[model samples]
Target: MNALLDLDQLRTFIAIAETGSFTKAAEQVNKTQSAVSMQMRRLEERVGQTIFVRDGRQSRVTDTGLRLLDYARRMLSLNAETIAAFSSDAMSGKVRLGLPDDYAPRLLPTVLASFATTHPNIEIEVVCEQSSCIHRRIQDGRLDLGIVTHGNRTQERNGRIIRSEPLLWVSSAHHSVHCQATIPLALGTKTCTWRAAATEALSKAGKKYRIAYVSSSAAAHTGAVMAGLAISVLPESALTSDMRVLGEREGFPEMKHCDIALLRSENARDRIHNALAAHIVNALDNVSGGAALAAE
Candidate 1:
């Protein structure tokens, strides 16, 4: 039995399995769709196993493919670690990172400060966008890694859960916005999971509400909340002194918890990338400096 596996094909195979779409996998690997198909065929031939099956124009991974996923990830991780271990030159390269705008003010400084302390030579390029946009960039290989809101565990194909925090309903500290008959709300766009959760919670609680403002920017959400225009949903970290938490006692329903995840691209195979990922995970896991909203 030939034990040799082409790492490139394995990488593409991992991409396909993770993304659940050949078209998306192709985009992530920067390959033509045909090229992606050809690579998968070759990979199947090499393994002598059927890895995927067509399901109504969609590619579904076979049992063998699911089994291979673990091996593939281990192989790639070991390969990258081996290369970095023996490399003579110290780690120094540019790593692209993406995250939602809301996280930058609180998350960026802490993460960058710690990482930079040890890896000053490596350049970190940051891009702030919506969590969905950041996820896409990581998939498309435009980013080395990203911090994103992990909505559904089953739907999040390629990311590690880093932090979990309660999603709180908040309004201006000095305002009576939450007292309105029809509770005015500021929230993310329609596609945002947070927005969906917020609306769903309101409906289930039999509360009347109206979307008074919609924006992807955290600053915009904060602005709406601060000016007493509307109540908004925010992660525990993003809370500020000027915001007051709303809960069942205040006639607001309990919101779902928000999870923060670290998503890495297939291109993130170097020590620098790994280092940054580790730092981010560590920083977030131990984070403590937000408005102390936890009830005693």
Candidate 2:
């Protein structure tokens, strides 16, 4: 009796459970629909349980499949921690990194420059994109590592956080958020952490706001607010520049701190990622020293 549940098959089942459709899961796992179905079948045979109840339009996990998914997530998470723990020694390589616009301008330069100065042998490739895009790329294995904002303390994705920064609402020189006839809003794309929080807070507070400006880049989002187009919420780190605070009412929901994480492949134990992660954590920890040096 084949009793050991296959890890790959379990992962596929988890994806299907999350998506609730085999087509979506197939795309997510980078397998053909038929291949994905075959893997699930084999997994069911090995476990001797019907994991999914499939209909023509949709599929849902049986109680057994749901139970298996919880274990699968833990297995993958532990599998990551195990790698990061042991694979602390290796040569750094061409490290491709993705960062959000605000982070790229604020903390990332110091982090990268320090890493470069320390390990001159490893070449660094950097891309500045929205945090949402960064997470997607990391999951797709298109990049080696990434730094993204954790809007919800989102650990579901395979990312290991290195630094966390608070998110706050900010506006132009003398303006604060007010429940006037209309509150002006400055926002990033739909995927941005700050944008969503700012809007949601307004709605929950029973205030009205119109997006005066929306940009894909966080820098542009902040820039719009600085230009007095509207109010916006952002990580304090994004306020690296001199700007006056406006209507910051205390006790507004604290947006999950912007988390700069090392979003790598399942191979968190991979030598290059481990080295880069260490270098990043160390550099971010020395925030004052690096900021001062960056000033020079």
Candidate 3:
């Protein structure tokens, strides 16, 4: 039998599977696209299995690939733990993390789990709030790090962007809210990024809309839409099966992309902060991929 799979190859495989594209996988792994393709071909040859099924411009993992993905994650995790255990400076510090309430449910579990495993001695203090509030806390030095949704497309010097997804108009599948002459909206608080973007898009398109329901909670906005009270604007990642996305065909204006950014304080140079930030980025990647699958 061939020797055990190379760790680097396994890492590359995982990246391709998670990212859903070879170009994206190359970016994640810091390899050329051709190199990544070569690695995948080599991996398949060694395993004697076809892992990914290629479509026109997309690739889907085969059943065999899905099974291998589970093992790949476990192996990489254990490899990381084993290396960290022997390292002289084992991470041992408390980290203050701020996240938006809307993202907590979808992103927290994977981040916390992976960080805890790698840095068992590090204690994570998480605060769930709105993105604007989290940005304020980070700027005030009250938080060591935070994940926020920024309305602007330009990158900030103090923040790193994890991903950017479209802000979309969504309504209840059971409602004809989109057809109303004056659109009724279920929006967030005045400080909410999505609310501001939605209104700006509507105004630019000469569309008339009314804020029919206002709440600070994502659940509340979703509930309002489900109750057919109003249509809501939300990030693509926040969409669910029951929500119908309204596009140009439905007369909805195009909205700007929301950037999911990681903000770090001056103390970000510390090992603990760096480790946590990496974990957060990795977790968000998985969450984004899952959200894409869910939307499909």
Instruction: Superpose all Cα atoms of candidate 3 onto the true structure and report the RMSD in Å to 1 decimal.
Output: 4.3
Question: 109-156 in candidate 3: lDDT tens per residue?
Answer: 556765675577788999988877787788788899998886553334
Q: Write the per-residue lDDT of candidate 2 for residues 210-256, one digit (tens) a residue.
A: 88888886767767776666667766655635455444363344455
Give the TM-scores of the predictions, in the order they appear: 0.68, 0.60, 0.78
Rank order by lDDT, top first?
1, 3, 2
- Which residue pairs in model 1 clash with each other? none
lDDT for each candidate structure: 0.81, 0.66, 0.79
> Lowest summed-lDDT stretch of 10 residues in model 2?
287-296
Model 2 / residue 234 / CA error / Å: 1.5
Candidate 2, residue 99: Cα displacement in angstroms equals: 1.0
Best by TM-score: 3
> Where in model 1 is the C-alpha error above 4 Å?
1-89, 153-155, 290-296
Clashes of 2: 1
